[model samples]
Target chain A: MDVGIKIIDSRGAACPGPITDLARAYRNSKVGDIFEMWATDKGVKADTQAWATKTGNEILETREDPDKIVIRIKINKR
Target chain B: MKKVLIIGGGGGGLILANHLDTNEFDVTIVDKSDLHFYQPWFLYIAFKGSKRKISRPIGELVRPGVNFVKDEITEINLDERKAYGSRKVVYNYDYIAIATGTSPDPDSIPGLRQIYDEYGDYHSNVYNSQKLWSHVKNFKGGTIAIGQASPTCKCPPSLLEGAFLLEERLRGMGMSVGTSDPLSPSNENDPTKTGEKGKSRIVFFTPFPRAYSAEPMNKVVEPMVKERGIEVMPFFDVDTIDVQNKTINSLEGDSLKYDLPIIVPPCKGPKIKFTPETVQDEERFIKADKNFMKIPGYDDAFAIGDCNTLPTSKTGVTAHLEAMTVSELIQGKYSEFNGRINCPFDTAYGKATFVIADYNNPVVPYPPTATKHFMKMSMARIYWMTLMGTADPIFERFFNITKPEKLNRKYSVPE
Candidate 1:
């Protein structure tokens, strides 16, 4: 079955908020599920990357806008 | 003279208002509370039961020329450069600086608000700190859960500081305490193994996988924590508190039993309203340029301290530096802030370390020493001098030694 991308909007949340939101969503998500997170906290950039790297997830892309940051990740592990 | 309206008479607002050239600008400060608090003292108030010298009247702190208005700022119309206060007063300003820092949101977590309401916490205010002291002062031995409920909080090191100090206080009270490594996983209730039956066990929790978010700082702190027998529960972001059961739950599917819970409540920006709503972010923190501290599209408008989205830790030191930088910027003396962080870490037993860093350099913990501890303690007493700019010469000299360039060179750490 094809899985749809889950959007986790964590804008205005600070460090760990975005990461935690992603982790929470990832835990309930099925394998092969894709996730996109939006955050305003600058720490989200490094945190999302580190969290993905540690959790064995693949970063599909990371887009940075003037006001917010968006990260796309594919779950590779439980 | 140009009228400058400063909302919130906090460390950043007071410092900026005091340092600004009174000859060139007419400054007025508006705050809900008439008192200025030395917030760093909250830790002492919690752990040490200190009740003196932590606050001063905001009126006394403001310089001779600065007008102090005791009213809550309800709205800020940046386009019109007007601010509305709770007293139904509207003030116009040529330039406006918002230093209204973040406020602790007790209700952010489930059951957490009631927990603090009943038992109190040091993070909230003087009353809460005192109430926390009363709750924990007579504690002999039990499970003391000290950690953060929020992902972001002011003074990141305060969690560890409280743990170390509380552990020390327990030991000083002649109680045997042993640490349980939550990183080890198995949640077997072996009180005999962890020494929880007849002794005090401090379980320090953090959302990060490591004891501290910063790796190098973690390296320095983890050892001290382990040495002091403080149990660490990493990756445990507080999800909720079961007050009846006396249990703390984490978002990561872990729960721990506790006798006394002293979790740092979540924080959010002030309740002040902005007309366009774009002035603040989702969490309501004012968005401003990292270098200039100026709100976008408005050259004369700025936000500093916990109120501004500076991408740094919410700390008084960050606020102080930004205040100084913005004060100078208003005078046409532009200096870019290097995201300097100078947080004093008290590791208990009269030893402390200064976690000094900036955007350019990583935090290299200075070897814990009594001198640093003393300096940290002394600053609490002389903090008023800093707000008044009376200690500028000495403070600037001290800051000079801890500058990012100096720290980078001294520690020889890569950027």
Candidate 2:
């Protein structure tokens, strides 16, 4: 089965919204499933990294553009 | 004269109503309740057993010219520029400001409301704060767990500050503050591992990875937290509180036993209905420009304070600054809110620190000092006058002094 990466769009959402979206996505995801998230809040970078570190998730990539922040996470554990 | 209608009579609404040019606009404020409460006082009430004056009649705080009406707004007719109230009164306005702020929703977390009701908490109304005070005063020394049920709550640093203050208070009562590993399997049966009984432990469970969300502020606070022996359990986004078991289980599959658990409740936007649906998001937070506080698709409508989806913390300081920005936008003045935040963080022992930040800057925290503590203590007394813009000049000076953006110039200059 070819499963595309799930995309979670949280653009323009404030602090904690991005993290909450990531968590909600994590709940339905299996180990090794990768998800991409987009957020506009500047604090999303720090928040995402912190949340990933504490939750035992892996950040595959983080790219920041002028308009939005894009982050990819691979589920490491439930 | 243009009619200006302000909703919710909160920090932002009251300031906007009072600051508008009364000569050019007929101002009115609509709120469900007549009481204007200084919510920061809830901390003092819970920890210090303070009976300090914190509430005043809304009418007493509203300026002489601004009409203060007691009415709960239910719906807005955008096309007609009319707001329908629960009292069946219709309000007409040339411009409207929605400042109906967020409320603590304990029901958001499973079993949270039950625990909150049973042990008392400081996150809701005055009665709940008083209940927490009773519990704090009568605490016989056990595991006191402070955690946040929601990731976003008003005064983001308040729970951490409460922990520091609580630890100090318990220690002052001759209760030995102990340390325990919350994740240890045997710890639940014996939460406190101190040498003697009646020893207390402060375990702070947070959704954020650090003690403070902002790294710079966390750098300053984490050390203080360790110095005070406050155990911080990071990534503990609360999932449920087992009321019968006296355990709080996190979404991360961990649980901690507590004799007393104080959870900061989740904040939700006002329940009022808005026209054109675009006025508010699915979360019910009003949609507005972060800098101008102006609602999209409407030139004359504005949303400020906790109701708006601003990127800053949900705090009165943010509301006050947004009020100033919206007030300027209404009066044909050119101004932009730089996302200034100047919140006081109480570090116990009669000392406090200021969390100062802006859009382009991370939080810059000063060392905790008695001077800042006194300033925070005096804020409640002067808050009403501030609504009337009586302290505008003083606030301007304070903001300038604490502006993190100006730190380079401040330190670079010769003494």
Candidate 3:
């Protein structure tokens, strides 16, 4: 809800489903486009971080709310 | 309906397209040829069976309602979710399963294609099985070398089968078959050379350390080679073929001269490009999940069979099981892919050897038996039924057990 951020609701999605949504979102995002994925799947944290690290993106912020893990990623040309 | 497009109509694609729910998904398979041949039958075809009897038209194979396209795939863009074909047809899909499989690129090896073309190396499978027949049939009987070009060759046991069957053929012709290499015996302690010149000699070569990895298989095969007087030349990593010298030099500082050479040329993966990292091995097999579902970086792409490095035997049976797993994963059913491989190796004259393996136990090649020969024949029929989609076997339980689907018929050739 800031200057430029895409909030992806992945609460009910499965392991790769949410990760896939995160990837698809990253695919469509421009440079400096921020993304926050709210995921209920516990594996999403590792998957997302691994994907981001592999694809050369920056993780802006990460925190776990009571119900789901929230991750913030910045789209880098890297 | 989710649109599923599959490339390569060999085993995995054929089985996957048939098993995919026609009601829930629009399945289309794109392949260059309208022919889907049972590959194992190539061995039989080279010996006694006819090519026409083993290969069938692709038009008759796929289940009804599944669309088949006769176009060669030129390029696959995972990011765009599109595959370009030779006919210039561009197709998009919700999901794509690549079962392009491995190919023996003789051209990839310097002078291999030339030597094969010049002398007619028929021991090779996939191609020249028919040509091998003519080569064997016209044989007045000398030395026939069944050797591998490298370690990455798919289905190494099949080479043993070719040697065994051809040895039996030469023996049937009343020619002395030699298993001991007169040129390069393992050591002085090894069996003495048993064949004189002009008699048919069968020296089998491989890059593997042993004839078969498992001890029990070694007990059987080593003795089989010794009994039949066939020679074993292991640790030969051939790099180039000097056809004039009738010798093949190896990358591992080894060389061997041969009369007729059947080289399973160093196999390479399909030429299609993928954008994902760690998605393929250095040799080009797509790295796959145990279940053969979803390339890690891409959302909707998956790979099966020899095209994907699943650590299973790169055989049609492994591809068949992978197809079942793919169906279970996509149709909203649960499945776990563990590496499982079973191959019934036809030894010759209505006899065969059996291998059953998994990730935990690894490769355990069991004893040879006549029953496994019949079992292999039964597999050919099962292959037909699978193509026709008539005898489609499905997973009855979601347990992590390997092939709860074929647990019954499995006992016919139980490990």
Per-prediction DockQ scores?
0.14, 0.28, 0.02
Interface RMSD of each: 6.3, 4.2, 16.0
On lDDT, the leading prediction is: 2
Local error of candidate 1 at B378, Å? 1.0
After TM-score superposition, what is the CA distance of residue B343 in candidate 2 from its true location, in Å? 0.4
Q: Which pairs, if any, clash in model 2?
A: none
**Residue by residue across B380-399, what tens digits does model 2's lDDT show?**
88888899899999999988
TM-score of each prediction: 0.86, 0.89, 0.75
| Candidate 1 C-alpha error for residue B353, in Å | 0.9
Window of ten residues with lowest summed lDDT in model 1 chain B = B180-189
Please provide, for model 3 over B1-415, each residue's C-alpha lDDT reduced to its tens digit, 9 standing for 90 to 100: 8999999888889889998879889999988888887778777767663554666777678888899999888788888888888767789998899988886678866779986665444334445776777777667756677866665555646778878888777767755665443433442322234324336677787654446533335556777777777777764556688888888876445677777777766666787766654577666778666655577776578898877755445677678778878878888778866556666777776788666554434344356689778877887776778655566543223123434234324433343
- Cα deviation of B123, candidate 1, in Å: 1.3
Candidate 1 TM-score, C-alpha based:
0.86
For residues B302-349, write the lDDT of model 1, one tens digit per residue. Answer: 999988877567888889999999889888886877777888889899
Better of 1 and 3 by lDDT: 1
- Arrange candidates by TM-score, descending: 2, 1, 3
Total backbone collisions, model 3: 5
